[model samples]
Target: MLTFEHDYTRLPEPLWLACEPSGVRAPKLIAFNEALARKLGASVVPDDETLAQWFSGNEIPSGAKPVALGYAGHQFGNFVPQLGDGRALLLGDVVDAEGKRFDVQLKGSGRTPFSRGGDGRSPLGPVLREYLVSEFMAAVGVPTTRALAAVASGERVARQMPEPGAVFTRVASSHVRVGTFQFAARHGEETTRALADYVIARHYPEAREQDDPYLALLECVTRRQAELVARWMSLGFIHGVMNTDNTSISGETIDYGPCAFMEQFDPRKVFSSIDEGGRYAFNNQPAVAQWNLARFAETLLPLMNVQGEEGVELAVEVIRGFEAHFDKTRQALRIAKLGLAEDAGDTADTLMDALETLMHQGRMDMTATFDALTHYAEGFDDIRREALLALTDQPEAFDAWLEQWRAAPLLNDATRFDAMRLANPVVIPRNHRVKEVIDSAMEDDFAPFHTLLSVVSAPFDESVEARRLAAPATDSQAVLRTFCGT
Candidate 1:
């Protein structure tokens, strides 16, 4: 039997509603993360039927206290006072063998009070997408929620069309978000204070040691968001929906809806179908993140050491630091991607800007270009150099930048090569490939899905299959828009 702790439920009742997962018909185990299960100290090896039943909400596990968490969000810059977990339930918390707490959630487990007239279910396409991309993110060393299991409901959900439904088991440090505090603030300052205390105790324990824990909490959350967004930029992963509620306080990439990796290096790329305004474009993530952090800081103003206008000023000061924090992390990642030493200095910035300009002008494939650079760093070969130059339309311009990069001061070829290999991935879950997997899975053929997952699991490895998947989409195969799959 699995064990659970209900620390979140101990908070004010307004924050969550005690609930149960809606049972599904013919729950069949589609995928079970056995390695993650063992890591969470799950010893019982139940049959597939039993596993599916438990995960699909056909049967609740022992010691589980399911609840639909309450939170508000800014949807595309417009504030929604109440936008809770419409289709997800927190089935309590589990502490792994190493003593780290993780929230086990059931997505597509049916409707709760939070479901605003829509079906509280997920299409199998989105479930499989999250499973593949999230696990791939973990493999690539990005902080993200882990997929524990996926079970087919043997039922169809109504979306743009009728689609197979599945419940996804998502494991995370906590589901607390800036929107959580936004909801709490509406309940009054006391509730907001209580929520902050709970979050600090749960995720940022070090903040409690500070003289002003609330301010420290804001600072820590700001730093984490900066680092998180920077990592997302490094991988060309565009989180299509970056609503305030979807922003996790723990800094892990949360909701994977409409999310896709950029195929071509265009800073203006926007893949989300709903985002016609380009509000959450590829280059705007850092600004959006800082904007969300400002919203979070507003929620904590009442608990800060200062009062009224002074407190607002203090919060603004901290929020303004986001740019510096983001730049520091992003610069380090760029330096590593270029396989340059930490002291590469102005040379790094100039080279990165020049390369990005060339890439944007050439409409080069981001992942392929970076992978080629990684190989070139390993050892300068004519073939690798030609391959890198081929990615850009302006070979002369790129060649000029290439010479500057190669001749930069304090060059150590061996260490630089190692750094590049670690920073650049040989493969990502490219848009077209992900669409192919989803298409195959919808027809009950899961071989393509499993094959893609296996390839992405070792992103750094340049295996034959990995190299094959790294190929960019042809014009006809390009997935220009991705849906939320609600």
Candidate 2:
């Protein structure tokens, strides 16, 4: 028997709306993460038929208390006072065998007060995309929400056209967001303080021991966001939307709408069809994260210091730390990717910058470029170098960076191949490949989707057949824009 706990209900009543997921028809199991289910300590895994019913919100489990969380976000630089979980329901928290707590929620469950006159359901494509990408992120060691199960609703939703409706079971550290603090701040000082205390106790227990716990919480969240976004940039993952509400206070990547991995490396890449001004572009992620953190810091001011100006000054100091933290983290990542030692820091940075310049100028495939370097480290230099040189119009620039890297003392390491393999994944969820999955699923064929998921699950492992997935898309296969599918 699984016990469901309602720790979130202890918060202020206005923070959420008590509700149950609207039932779906003919719910059928699409995919299940059996490993994750066992990790969550389910003694008996239900049959697929029964599992689908529970995940689709057609059948409630024992001791479940569903609710829709409330929050406010600055959407594309404009503050929206109210935006919350319109179609998602927090079923309850489940404690794993390892004693870690995770919120188990059903997205596309149904309508709630927070729906804001919109349909509270998710399209099939987005549901599968989130499941695939989130699990892929986890496999690659990125902190992100995990997909537990996906269920077909036997219903269709109208987006750009008629699309199948589906429900996704998501497991997360917590659903709390920077916008949650923003919501508390709107209610006044006491509410914000209470929220700070609660978040500190739940996520940052060390903060409670600090002389100024709220400030510590601010700094902790700041550093985590810095590290998280830096990793995203290193992996060429472009989060199309970085709104305050979508920015998880827990620092795990959440809300994978319109998100994509770049085929050709470009700092100004924008995949979200809705982002007209390129506010959340590939290179702008770190800056946008810092921008969101500033909003978060604004909510912490009342609790940081009694004097208003002093609090603002303190918050500004913490916000400034984001740049230093991001630069250090991103640089360390680049060093590792290039198989460099501590002494090669400057050289690694220069090599990375030069490579990025060459890639951008030559329109090189991001994942392939990194993957080829791993082969080069494994002593396949001649073939890999020739292949890489063929892709670049700026052969001189590429040759220059290669020469600098070749001379670095770090190249003497005997385990360079192992190190580079760990740093560079063999495969990512390519846009063309993911589109292939969605197109097949739309035709009620899920073989392509399952195969793609399996390939991405072990990103670092090298397989002959899987190497085909690493290939860059052709001009006809390129996907320029991705939709929210709301």
Candidate 3:
């Protein structure tokens, strides 16, 4: 029953100490996430003037503290003791009619205790990138943080260049990260145990009834993350930054900076401008999740039992299941795209090999190649297969690959068309196209953004106007490096 201005002092004790809002410069109103705001049953759209005040730091909402919740993270390969919401502040948790909880926070709001030397503001380009990318991710059935609204903070943020500024009201299951536990664990056993108990009560309430609640929490998070990363791989998503801080305990993908959907099926594809070493490449994601989970395990080790070594041993055993869980989910997705029902005796490896060869040789459009094949077989046209195969240099590879594929029973199934449509999306928010939308919107020509947003919103449909969305970029137009607007 908090009003919009109860002040930070009366919120959570962790957020009690904080500076007041120092309104940002150059504030402007950009976009409102009508869909997400409605999901929260929170309407700020009719109150446009107040949006500028709240986003630009001219006002702080009720139950919100201007505090930057603290945590530690492994940035790239190194651990930093500090990397909180440097430019953001938690506005407390919002609960829905179903009693589900969500954290509503303002990104690019302003500087905080964790601001360090950074300006603590977000640029409009990244704001659009996140809003578009995150919404598309959510619509695609991927667990992701949703954007509530975006407010242009009549300001400029510096990167290599200056740009117009904005703020996003980002909603997520919980802001708790692997780094959150790491921060507590690194501090001491008491803090680690406290965080673990809090997390169990908040996220995995069922774990509270378990004999070893902390270990149960570890297992729960590991399973959720395994399934989450598998879903990403199924769609060719490479989360450029797989830092512990970016790893959410609620299993949703957060920190969409520098993330890219694979243009081709190369397992080694690395698109993040910040990922020079390819540590978080397409194939490396599962392994990185394992690594990050190990960190989580370490945090909960002290709580596994009264004896430390016993606790560590138990956590490691549960963590080992992460790889197998990811593999099972991944293999399920792979076979589904080819209209192959899950089976034991079938060799999915050979089918995957054929797809890989096609991708490597001719840059065969990954989403389209399998999508087209799902409806085609002996009774259909081998010519369509051949024509589609022509898109790749591995026509010979596709030829060698198709012999056994034609023998695959599901290709002839009456419901193959239905299965294929469900397995393959007709569209993704293509990088180049997304960049175009952002660029056009930046110039105040929001027509392109509006159009693409409309098309990409329903990625499974075959809209005549959206034919462009199903196609790959021209060779010259391929965006090689994606950046995390961090």
Give me the runs in candidate 1 sitting further than 4 Å from their true place: none
Q: For residues 249-342, what per-residue lDDT tens digits would candidate 3 score against the true structure?
A: 8899998888888877788999988788989999889889999999888777667754667666787888899987877777777777767756
lDDT of 1 by residue, 231-328 (tens): 99999999998999999999999999999999789999999999999999999999999999999998999899888998898889888999889888
Q: What TM-score does candidate 2 reach?
A: 0.98
- Ranking according to TM-score, highest score first: 1, 2, 3
- Candidate 1 or 3, higher TM-score? 1
Candidate 1 overall lDDT versus native: 0.91
The weakest ten consecutive residues by lDDT in model 2 span 404-413
Better of 1 and 3 by lDDT: 1
- TM-scores, all models, native as reference: 0.98, 0.98, 0.92
In candidate 3, how many Å is residue 267 off? 1.3
Model 2, which residues run further than 4 Å from truth?
411-413
* Evaluation by lDDT, superior candidate among 1 and 2: 1
In model 2, pairs of residues that clash are: none
In candidate 2, what are the lDDT values of residues 334-408, reduced to their tens digit?
A: 988988886677888888998898899988888888888878777756888887687778878887778877888
| lDDT (CA) per prediction | 0.91, 0.89, 0.75
